[model samples]
Target: MDEAKRVEEGLAGDGQTQLIKEDCQGDLHKKLDRNDGGDRVEDAPEQPMAETAEEQLQVVKQKSKRVATLDAFRGLTIVVMILVDDAGGAYARIDHSPWNGCTLADFVMPFFLFIVGVAIALALKKIPRIKDAIKKIVIRTLKLLFWGILLQGGYSHAPVDLSYGVDMKHIRWCGILQRIALVYFIVALIETLTAKRRPILLEPGHLSIFTAYRWQWMGGFIAFVIYMVTTYALYVPDWSFVAHDQDVPRRYAVKCGMRGHLGPACNAVSYIDRQVWGINHLYSMPVWQRLKACTLSSPNAGPFREDAPTWCLAPFEPEGLLSTISAILSGTIGIHYGHVLIHFKGHSERLKQWVSMGLCLLIIAIILHFTDAIPINKQLYSFSYVCFTAGAAGIVFSAFYIVIDVWGLRMPFLFLEWIGMNAMLVFVMAAQGIFAAFINGWYYKDPQNNLVYWIQKHIFINVWHSERLGTLLYVIFAEIVFWGVVSGVLHKLGIYWKL
Candidate 1:
């Protein structure tokens, strides 16, 4: 999440700044030195060893060369992730689309991939040795995969469910962290492979940046082609799956002899997942169950409709193989933004590049979506979906840059900055329900009488007397704000959990 920064130092004719720097260095140096990665520098000398004013100014400049806006943007994404996951059940529009449209929750995964792309540009800007870069990428990839499988693989049932562990035959293979690992591996390797190639600096408006990062863009395009070809050209035959009703397994057949069908019944995305991961291993309770066609209770999960289609009972993974190919394009779009941050030093130039690219993407998305050529669907990870989300991501990121980096509005967003700095930790504890599980494990008397349940019931629900409003408020105050404060404390202690 690193980006280039400019530091403005105020030097007084009375030599007052130097005196302040000398006094502040003792405490500031310790705090700054403990910061992870690009956020920190070499420990400052206890005494001002610099004999000249120029040397002292260099020290100040070096200490302030990391981007604060990037952290704020990442933190904002984390907050949204918490909000959608915790409160989506109460508000259907905020939840992921049941089949073929975007919603608040659908944006989380792409936003993460977009941020990862920006991070890759900053992280591997200069890879001195290919072997070292490969080693680091592999290690981080393995770690993400491990955590993904552990957290989302049915290993720890939290909150409502006190039980933990899942049968190996039914463990889910793909999820948020797992998809991120795959995307990161591919995108990082591409950047590393092309790190040595120098870009020609043509005029800014003349597709110059595209020419510079053309190889990465080309790679993304190739992946998109593979996804499109498979989705349309590959035939999906009749398939049967076992549906357990009242603990009684019954095999039902679904008719799908089509080559190109984007419906819930048959699509290359779900087909590929079922063929590879097996039906038992896929996500049993997919978002499609919330569709009006399938659910007796529209926009929510409940009893199935009397004539609900057989496919409604089948399992599907949203982060399946074919869809992930389209997701790679999302990461590449992010890389383009990161490259803008790196090559362009001037604020206006950087913003101009970001806004222009963002608008172009949005325009393309609108055409595709309106024409029905590629409907915006998160389940399928449609081309229009990628364009729309990535385009929106670029615009949102630029706004944050303007607000936090340019306008110096840091005080208002300090909470987000803290969460952004320790994003992984918060993702595990809050979003994954690890912290909730732990507190629930220590409940008094009945398992339902946990601290989390009590607070949500007494403090939020009872006071408000509205299920939807109370649930939303609980997530906002108890989950998002509480985690923000925890992350802030961790940030103050100079603690960060990196990948």
Candidate 2:
């Protein structure tokens, strides 16, 4: 994900909720496809027949099982997403880092993407036909992109006409879901290319966890190297950096890269956006404002004099083209976790590998940050930022995996699992202000206007005396409860959103 405005985001799973099916004689059985590499699980418990197909499906699912760990991880990520996105305006840590650094907010999308990678491995692990997998991938990618576009207040805000509706003059092309769609598509494509359908151990013929990890790790490393090289050595900008009338040395450009050149006009990622979409086509919020050069009345006025900042003024999206590259890398890290889950047998071995990967990435991130060779910038999706977020996500999900999957502790997190199962739907609804729409639609004018304001003013603000904390709590409760109820119903009905 990118900046708060272009706003960064997270991923999805392999869609195989119907892994358990009814045999012809009405017996429950888990069908392990020979092509994708799913292990055969015990049959689902028998259920009473229902009159309709939908009801039967619901009944069947009620007795079936799933990878509880994945659901819980996803659930946790979406829960955090709701909390952050709902009241981020009141909390700095929940919104994206202003320009650089990691926050709880930054991990939401990457964690989701990580779940998606794992799900992809799980769902497609048993697919026999690569063509079929490809088809599904294409369809899911399009749907994600569609949701991404719609959430931009595109179709949601009426007219939708060139003249009246969405301000086409500044329609954002890149966004959370759009980036998700692209990342999933690319990652899925990578899976497809590397996938081998040759039978082994009389089981399915699909990309082995071992093979997939190697391909992803190798490709990710190569892509990162190329990304760094182009950004550093080859991106010859028309303008050169100078301070104290001293032109910046090439060594700094090769060493420091984008950190040294934060000008609105500089950086390969922002430059690509300007070239492809121009300023108007990208996101517009807290629009970049360039101050006119002026002499500081006092040298101590700020960290630097008025002349120190870059002069170019244009709001470039954080989730633009190049940052998407880094995002996919985060997803790559997730797929590696996916492999560990699938193939690694020993618990100690699994935990060791998982924590080891996290540590490696963290060490790399620390090195980059301490040396100032690069900064951990979520806005730019810097290498350090990607690695840092991925490492944190891995450790966090690993913990969830232990508690829920291994320990079999389920009751406390069932509500979150419900949210996780329908994560994309919840995010879309929240992002488009659907919760506000319904709540506001049922107007409760109690001195305070909207539902959010009314609830907080009465139940929270009156008690806390802190406007920010109270308002934040109000949003979280309203949105979470609303989505929780909706997802609960959907879950009970055996409905889910998946790609």
Candidate 3:
């Protein structure tokens, strides 16, 4: 049958798996042949209509059995990424936290990683050959890294400058996509190493989920221990960095002859990044500079305060190497959720496992945060941050699964699904500022007169009369909604950008 007919047939089947039950198809056909009064139709259609319908239904259900919630979850993350990247300037609370607290923007990266784990579990459920898996994983990681470096490696001067070029000496070496590539590579390798030739679900036990993937958990724990030890035990010597004031650069000394410091100035996260990536290669415009110590008006970038600390002006990479090691834990936690989706066939069973795990993580995170043992710092990718964000991600994914997959309420979230399916495309175009930069290149009457500028100024700011609110609205409509529609149209055309 056609696509629409197949979707209908699939929907008419099981709500959770969206697959027709083979054994029940005969019963369904029998019921269909009977009249309303329970008497069989003596003269039914002789075209074998019931048999044809059953065959068509089975075909459709099998084709449509893939999970929809995963796409929706990924789409939700892309939307948030666009929102925070575009409009975070208008709202500080939604922006990246300056030093040691969680914000709306802080959860995006971890959420991405968590879902990556889930995707991994689902995708790698049946790997026929270990060699092929390794090849695919390496190739995918390389592609991700290539795009990450190309998109985020200071190549495009988006929104601000029409010119596009960067000095290789000062280009940033680490970013969101790069970190994702790293996480994916490491985690995928772990999954491959711990994978069984047969499905882990075949192993009989209530604790198969944990027992099956125990090695991956151990790997993650070992990584975490390494991070914790390096973070608290490593000695951070006094260092100096050059801070540019206007066009002039001045060297500033930061004293940190201590260990186990989580402060912005002396954290091991920053120290390792500076040493490995070099200070000049780190992210020039770090979120830490928005702190009160650096900005007289907190949470906004401006002229540095008169008494701002030395580290405030120094460069820092939020997606640095060591912090990424901690980030692996987030991926590991996500793998557990994905395993639940793979191992458990029943909706209630999956929900029970996910919700319990999510709550446990959230509770632990809250305790860590409240006790000040490990604050929820996104820059450091703190343990508490991983727990909190991963837990929230699990809960959120479960919600989407319930609403869209379990209830078959897919229409309302179809846009999200489209975007999620083509997330990398939308992310590169919108969140990475490539689209803005492209449109910005063709400006009228000087570089300031562009479609983006005009829309923000006239359509949003002019109508709203408030810069902050207008900017927020502009992002919600011009960026988020606009991309959602574009993704939907692309979905209609079967165009997806994947690595």
Q: Highest TM-score: which candidate?
A: 1
lDDT by residue (tens digit), candidate 3, 115-220: 8887776565545567877897898787777877887888877757778788998888888888888888888898887666335344777677787788889879
- For model 1, the run of ten residues with the poorest summed lDDT: 6-15
lDDT for each residue of candidate 2 in 54-124, tens digit (9 for 90 to 100): 46546544543444667667778877877776576566545665555676778876777777676666555
Ranking by lDDT: 1, 3, 2
What shift in Å separates residue 336 of candidate 1 from its native position after superposition?
Answer: 0.8
In the predicted model 3, the residue pairs found to clash are: none
Error of 2 at 422 (Å): 1.2
lDDT scores for all predictions? 0.79, 0.61, 0.77
Q: Backbone collision count in every prediction?
A: 0, 15, 0
On lDDT, who's better, 2 or 3? 3
Sort by TM-score, best first.
1, 3, 2
